[model samples]
Target: MRRALLAITGLAAGTTALVVLKGTPGVTQVAQDRPVAEAPVAPGGSAAPAPTPVRSAAPSAPASAKPSAKAGVSRSPGAKSSTGARSTTAALKATTSAPKPANRTVTGPVVSYKYGSLQVRITLNGTRIVDATALGMPQSGQSGLRSDDVQARYSGTAGEVVAKQSANLNTVSGATYTSDAYRQSLQAAIDRA
Candidate 1:
């Protein structure tokens, strides 16, 4: 009974693998005498370019089984055996040809000062600082007025860092503790970058 069950499972697995291979683009071909055009559905929902036909090892299917659409598929003299490898190679080529973006961003470590937590996120265009965002500045324990004050101070100090394109910002006058926290966080992010 166990052997019979195992045999059935193996057969099911084989059938599933076949179904997958049949649908995979450039991986399996049903025709042997002539290259059949098939818009084999790509891994992505979008259809990939027509597969370059490689020689098939499997027996040819009846003409009725092959799709009638011939325009989308064509035969190529040199075809790769593995569709996955070909797609990966294509992706690599595309990435290598394109230039990486000049903008860089880093999130600073959180700095806790005087019952408040502060963090800074900075965006850079090459060596110049483009923007800074303050995060986690509003203390849950503080009143609404105090939270608003902390946010304003950190943002103003962050603006100074952006304008000067440096983390060396002087503390905002009214928000000395928050300003110090911002400075520490900003420096940590810069060091990471």
Candidate 2:
């Protein structure tokens, strides 16, 4: 029994020592594998000069790790330097952007209604209508008031004309004649565009 107890104690101590020894090397390997940027620096401010010397001695590690570090250093300067990279990006943007069709104005023939005659001018960006403006609208008495209402609802960039992208618009409540004439003129302008 005495010999068995001694044997068991010896085995336990040997196991504990082996574990300590194995764990230490693993920790040192992990520290060595960490990136230079994450390596702990001495608090004495002499750490900067230390890395310069270490980098100069490329053969300190196995041949495998050195080639990769050298390749990374060589590739990074070409890939990330500001002048070359910026020009490449700018060239790519220029080619991709090119130029789009310019905006143009198309004027429609005047349409005569019972109140008066009104004409429309539309600004188009390529095939899309961007704005509508009434060039001539009734401006006397009750017809003028109705024309004003129609113009407010159907003209400019935010108007129903651009929003609907067509002459098919809802009639202003009390401006039937003005709305009809406006629609006709707007339709003509779209056709001309």
Give the top-scoring candidate (lDDT): 2
Per model, how many backbone clashes are there? 0, 0
Over 4 Å off, model 1? 1-101, 139-158
TM-score of each: 0.42, 0.57
Name the 10 consecutive residues with the lowest summed lDDT in model 1: 63-72
Predict model 1's lDDT versus the native.
0.60
After superposition on all CA atoms, what RMSD does each candidate show versus the true structure?
A: 14.7, 19.7
Model 1 per-residue lDDT at 148: 62
Q: Could you give me the TM-score of model 1 versus the true structure? A: 0.42
Clashes of 2: 0
What digit string (tens of lDDT, one per residue) describes model 1 on residues 1-193?
A: 9667666655554554454334433344543223334454555687645544433323343222323223122334343435444544455356558565698889999888875687889888777777777887774544334546645544543567777766677666566777778788888998888
Clashing pairs in 2: none
TM-score of 2: 0.57
lDDT at 99 for candidate 1? 69
Model 2 ranges off by over 4 Å: 1-87
